[model samples]
Target: MSVRKQQLLKQHRRNKRIALLAIIMGLLLLGFIAPLWLLPLAVLLVWVVHEAWFADHLFYSPQDDYQYRFPDGVQPLSLRLVNGRLQLQESSLAQQATVIAKVQINSSWLGRWFDPSICIGNDQQTFERGAHGVRYLNLTGQVEALTTAGLAVQGRFCSIATQIQLYVFTQPSPTAGNMMILAPHADDAELAAFGLYSGANNVSIVTLTQGEVEAEYYQRLGLSQQHAAQLKGRLRAWDSMAIPLWGGVAQTHCVQLGYYCMQLPKMAKQPDVPFASQQSAEADIRTARRHNTIQLPGDATGLPTWQNLLADLAACLMHFKPDVLVMPHPEIDPHADHIATT
Candidate 1:
């Protein structure tokens, strides 16, 4: 017998012995109880005894070992139970790009209704039960990132194994063409389009908003007034640094439209809403009076109107005449500003 089967057999025998003892003890106690109540009490006692004895078996059972191998040149990924925990093992893909792992898990009979918590990659990812006790989770990060990155199921009633697959795509080479990246916020381009932005030859990043709404975030961190004033400058500096990081000799253009953050979706939807300045909410009331703003293209004013915003964006497109245009997905992206910009 396999090691897992041997363990299961030993556990089953132990539970059987405990259950038998509980039944005998229950019968002995029932002799002192009223004869009419004996049947109900006996049933309750037996259920409690059985549950205690077989609780561990509810999660684990002996099953045939399974192995999964990916196509040649692709990293092979495998799922297995090691010492009662579900784990994912993979052969290293000799690349420095990010890897996204897609995992799907299905529950057994009891777990279908009871459900359980499933963890992935050092508990970085967690999934609850879904309809029909099925759950899907996606984990994305740089290659060879985590030390204990794997899948784990946590529930006494859970008994199903996990399935996982990896996706890795090669980054395109830098070419001499105009590339425009439309970012809803200052950091959006850095987060979503860093890889693409770093590879493009002539790139123009248009930030729809100044991201001034992060004032609250800075306040929460107890930053001083001087530091807060320097926030926008720091962000602009970071944008300039991207050109050197990408090995691009040509200067990268950064266009900032100083629109209020957290209000883009509302303004985009209802164009008539009055514009609110993010500078009004400042840590030091004195510094809030000074407006150090970037110049917008097309001689655009700091207007919150959707028409002006569209016109400015149009002017940027016309000026750049980009061969490749990248913007956030409208419906799929969860951020309201991203959706509005898209």
Candidate 2:
């Protein structure tokens, strides 16, 4: 299980204990104390019990508001804004980034039973920050939309200190990804699917149906079924979204390169872009260096030959001394070379 899930479970158990205590105390007071005091005590007990019994649901419910935090020095981030705009102060970020919170509400029968904190409401925000340092997310947006339903999400995170532009806006046509409406929707299967599309505007993202996912895989990674379902569903709903997530792209590669440099024994100075290259392979290498902080070969981690395919990476880092570095998550299945690089 993920550290987040474990923490959440711990918190849940604590809340449950608190609720049980409050109830017991309230009952005792009712039997032996004044009506006014006892009545207030009873009410408090009820509220606490409600929170404890339904903490998970209360958490994941759309109405609940939350903020994710990173301790000092954490890096990388996975952010989600459902019904709110995220305001980030680039300067306040520390070197490392960690997910301080994962809040949401799931209104499924099994969810409510297996995890009683399930409730029905219209707001949801999840945080998946990577790295091991602290960063800040300024939730300085309006809360009016958050109080309502029908998904509105905006997610962004730094891959290698350079933030890629990923915005999801709302439109009439369901702009971004393909939208899948759930038919005969059950509580466990209410959400269909949506795809992430390259629309004319930013908000062109899609929604997906739940049945079309391998939930267990993500669940094993400590993500809630709902969260994993949505991500996979979104991919299925969108065209070429899988490419960015799977294949290596220059921009994405650079992002990873920036992240890797930050961890080396010594960092490099940022590279200078001489000119744009027409060849993608050459261009990818060049662009990777251009935005990089460490100048060629200097920022790389391992020795040249030992690194093999990573020779270019080492060279890129050495040429461009970036403060941070990032690389794609090495694929563990079906591809040996990719896994080796990852």
Candidate 3:
């Protein structure tokens, strides 16, 4: 920014703050004070005034930035997204550049109200500063790679970071080879990568859990929580194994590990501790195992512990010896299990 622009922005903010204080003073002079019993309503009235003044500049729904396009050279960023920095050039950024990306960062409701000043070179813009489903980032005359844009999503840690692609990139075609697809739940394999490896040869689908925690999905069947959960697992497990047949995977190639849903990270964290299923209340995976086509590899623990899952997954890998492996991107997938699957 030029010295003139910087001065103007500073003056602008100072004016807003002064104006806000003036409003408060004016209200007080106007005898706007309320009785003690109306304290809650008084606070609400003050908040209304503040929001009305900030409605145009401070608040924005990030989801509104759904569609974005970039000029013809940017490709799929080849560099690692270590933190939020899009490390394009090895040097510091030049003062002038362009908005090369339309990014959608997952943030909390509170975070949405406050802009995350994304830094690209010396240019730092916020999600509220751009339009059309993308956060504009500055990237041009590279002066340094030391600069960065970081996201501190409120309410929770970072979740899915979906963004529109502005860069140009090529993808290779899938070929015949030993390939394995690991689904954290029943349909994840299909939703996350059906088109990715459906045409590939020698594909194996490995479902880690029966998704027993989704028992609420079967509540209409007039069954108890445990029965409904167990039933959902059985049905979804079959969907996980059988649906891929249409995609050309051999029926025998699909297998289920028969663990509970939403409990994977816990199982991994407490590998030795036996965590019972919240839905089934059963301390074992025997029910889910009944739907498996492939046997547990090696002397599998068959217990609901993290070590057994790791051992089972390792054995499956050895059995397939896949040339290519497919799993969720821990940084991108929203589900915790999907993140743990990787």
Candidate 4:
């Protein structure tokens, strides 16, 4: 046997032993520590080793034939795994494996000794917010089969059905705080309806953080012929790498709420004093109109600053129906406007 093959064999055996030990120790530790915390890592290690063994075997033999299959309307994915880079592209819509793609990898010294990533685009959902789509993974034996076949894959493979709704607005606008829109935090009924809590495959909204999205990338997050053309060239798309455990997905409409929310003036010190006498109040309404602001009504109400601000806020909230409303407490800092708005 070649020296390289001999070395690979030894490494494979060692990995197997380590994986076995992890499983055994993890199970034993479950008695003392929370299984929820330790078991996932343990399982991940087992998967890594099992995949590594197969990958080495495949790497050692290039002549072994392989076949990739997919269901109808289901597209095969092209993944390139070179070093630590993972590139995934959607195959032709024909629903068959006609191309072999690789994922990119970045392997460091420590990674080589520990766990090295094989695939890069697993958790990627939509390319942009409000664009309804997801990269679906079929949890059949094929992925594991591929991993064992000497292809590098990271993490556990579970099958999930994916669908996405891309909501795009042709006219682009800036959002307040650069926060990505999120679905309203799920209520108990929503959780049940979406099967989120029950672990069923229902459509649950997820909101990526601000960093995950680039608003300038698309004219509107909604579907566009220009974007459609772009999709035509690419094989696959992935959501940017998000901190797997820290971020979540939610749906959001693109607009600035604070644009209107901030316009509300603080209540006057005397509740009975009408806002008509306040120069800031009159200027605020005019400024809002010139800016094409959606909140201010032209009908003049001779109410106090506080009353007028509250009425304006109520209207803005009703129109926006913000899933998460962000309001700054001016009272804490005591800005003249803040004091009045509060």
Maximum-lDDT candidate: 3
**Candidate 4 off by > 4 Å:** 1-268, 275-284, 293-295, 298-304, 329-336, 339-342
Clashes of each: 0, 83, 13, 42
- Per-residue lDDT over 179-261 for candidate 4, one digit per residue giving the tens place of the 0 to 100 score: 22222111212322222212321112221111111223343557354343233212111121111112232222221111121
Model 1, runs deviating above 4 Å: 1-177, 217-252, 272-274, 278-300
List pairs with backbone clashes in candidate 1.
Answer: none
Q: Give the TM-score comparing model 1 with the true structure, all chains together.
A: 0.44
Off by over 4 Å in 3: 1-176, 298-301
Better of 1 and 2 by TM-score: 1
Worst 10 residues of 4 by lDDT: 235-244
Candidate 1 lDDT over 144-167, as tens digits, reads: 433244344343344444444455
Poorest lDDT segment (10 consecutive residues) of candidate 3: 151-160
In the order shown, what is each candidate's alpha-carbon RMSD? 15.5, 19.9, 13.8, 22.7
Cα lDDT for residue 158, candidate 4 = 19
Candidate 3 residue 272 Cα shift, in angstroms, is: 1.6
Candidate 2: worst-modelled 10 consecutive residues by lDDT: 181-190
Residues 162-189 of candidate 2 have per-residue lDDT tens digits of 2312222222344332222111111111
